[model samples]
Target: MGDLSTTDRTRHRRLREQGRTGRQELFDVLGAGFVCHLGVIVDGAPMVVPTVYGFDSEHVYIHGSVASRSLTGEGRTVCVTVTHVDGLVLARSVFEHGVNYRSAVIYGVPRALEGEEKLEALRLLTEHTAPGQWEYARRPNRKELAATTILAISLEEASVKIRQGPPDDADDPHDVWAGVLPLSTTWQAPVTDPSAGHDVPDHVRRRAGTRIG
Candidate 1:
């Protein structure tokens, strides 16, 4: 409900003013977006892979192909990040120019899930991408489930940061105009499949013209 307890790893050092320790802020950032970049070390080299994710109160779940190098290994620590760019803050000085955004970074050792847990994680992932999608779509079969890999990363160690408002160089006099160019993603009209001769579902229709992430 308030600020989250910070650990050594999650402590803010650089840009301390921008760091946030609230657990709810972390949840909001994660919930606002569907994609995340998963950072890990594979074969002594650093690898960052972009993937879709879902989260509960305590854990974040990411899934991929069973043979994926990023998800196969167990007991491996990884970093997952979700970010939403809200706008561009144009400033009188280039050095002061920045972006309005919300972001979260989570650090934890990933654990592979099996059986019902795996299926449930997949459901969460789908629903996260599009609410009510899991119920509307067909459930995965045994063969499909067997070919997928799901990893759970704990949310115990994480950090959140948010930036907003007009440029900081408001006091600096400049001939050029300065302001925030706000940005947002919105769902367009639904494109129906040619094979499926049915109208868009009510749930899908409700998302039309709505802002996303």
Candidate 2:
């Protein structure tokens, strides 16, 4: 909301330090990761579930089964968070050790989309899962759409917080290795399903050529 701000909000949970309050910072954090942990109230209790999400300028979309209890109902809000762990920051002192990562938390009321918008939102979700694969895949039909549920969460009251590089120590210095050991996730060669002996297409092969994370 209000195009987001580079300054932290007065609200404690909404404030972000380490100079990472920009809208682009939040977007980059979200775009770099596909899975998000969605937090919301369910049946008067707190619940957090991991789900794949897509984004436009102002809204993040998540899809699930139509019978999902976590995403249903009206006028209810949810918090969705995306995080990417870049490396493990190991300091000489145990107390100074930490993690290097980027994370974004978005707070908004969930709105369910219908008809064509549902389909479009689903396309966004699919593309977010794997870029360029949405159009390359078959489109969902009416019955399929009806069976699925898509919810739109406005990108309001969001915050981006990140920690990177080596660990920080105040005064004590120990004689040990102190640096970051970067962590990375990559895709390997795709293994063909035994059931599909030869039906696998060339496009599928091409799609699996690169790593994603």
Candidate 3:
């Protein structure tokens, strides 16, 4: 509920104006999407993998197969990032071109979860990506859970950055074109499988054509 405490790693040394300090700002950027890029070191090699995630007020959760190379270590530190590109900043000059976006970067030593918490985290992950599917689909069994590795990272050490609006080239004397090309994401129609043999539920139907980002 308090403003995000700034840490040495989170301090914005450049373009500080774009840096966001509010905890809700971090939530907004994260809640807008279900995917995040996770960075970690595997076998002394740096790896950045795109993965689906879930989060609560306190932690962000991600999972992988038990034998996943990136998920092999315990007590390993990681960096997770989520980003949404809102628009393109088109300026009169190429050097001034930029992107309008919302992003959050989290740093922490992730700890693997176990027992009921692990099951709950998987439910969170499934529902976060597909709102109604957790109860609609079959839950994971003991063998499935045993084959999965779920990790949770605290939200305490995180930072958000957002950039919006038109290009900042108004002051420059340029007769050329300059503007923002806005972008948005939306859910498309669902493609069904014949083997499923059922009508789409309202919970799933309602989200079709809904907007995102």
Candidate 4:
């Protein structure tokens, strides 16, 4: 895969060393996570929405209710951001303390998909979050499809930054010890609803103990 370009919007002017290169790095960061923050301008004001997103070779897809004003953003461009906190970087001094993380900021004009493409995008969204849920659960019907809107934003322009490793203040003369406190997310046991009375399916049950981004 080609390395992503560092354009005006994407170029990291500060903390240049922390900026990541290549499109594959972007894919890794996005593929490991299921949620994103969508930023847009709506009704002459700024609105940031927490939403689920999926990405493929060329685009990142976000969806919501057809009636959502934020989804139908007033302007052409929107920003989608995904971040994963890996650890806390403890330093000898508070000023040097930081977080170890992977983040991506994508900017593009969203194009609403339709018909079969929209359905495909929805499936992508489902499979991205829960690998086999699309096939395991009931698929969306016509009316449900009509009430949903999926927007695909191009991946052509995106900014990715990754910070890792131990504290940068390891050599500090201060007496306080510095280290990294790791953090992670993992899948818990699947719960069965009493009303449904259905046993846990293989696909859902298999996710237990799995680590997430």
Query: 1-213 in candidate 4: lDDT tens per residue?
Result: 897877799889989999987899999999989999888877778788888988889999988552277655544788899999999999998889999999999988888899998999999998998889999889989998998889899898898999999888777789887889999999999878878867888989989999999
- Runs of candidate 3 exceeding 4 Å displacement: none
User: Candidate 4, 35: how far from true, in Å?
Assistant: 0.5
RMSD of 3: 1.5
Task: Give TM-scores for every candidate, taking all chains together and pairing residue i with residue i.
Answer: 0.93, 0.85, 0.95, 0.95
Error of 2 at 76 (Å): 1.3
Give all candidate RMSDs, comma-separated: 1.8, 3.1, 1.5, 1.6
Q: Write the per-residue lDDT of candidate 2 for residues 75-97, one digit (tens) a residue.
A: 77778889888889888788778
- The local distance difference test score of each candidate is 0.86, 0.75, 0.87, 0.88
Q: Compose the digit string of candidate 1's lDDT tens values, residues 41-93.
A: 87888788788899999899998552277556666778899999999999999
How badly does each model clash, as a count of residue pairs?
0, 0, 0, 0
Sorted by lDDT (best first), the order is 4, 3, 1, 2
Evaluate residue 157 in candidate 1 and report its C-alpha lDDT on the 0 to 100 scale. Answer: 90
Q: In lDDT terms, how accurate is model 2?
A: 0.75
For candidate 3, what is the TM-score?
0.95
Query: Between 1 and 2, whose TM-score is larger?
Result: 1
Task: Check candidate 4 and list the clashing pairs.
Answer: none
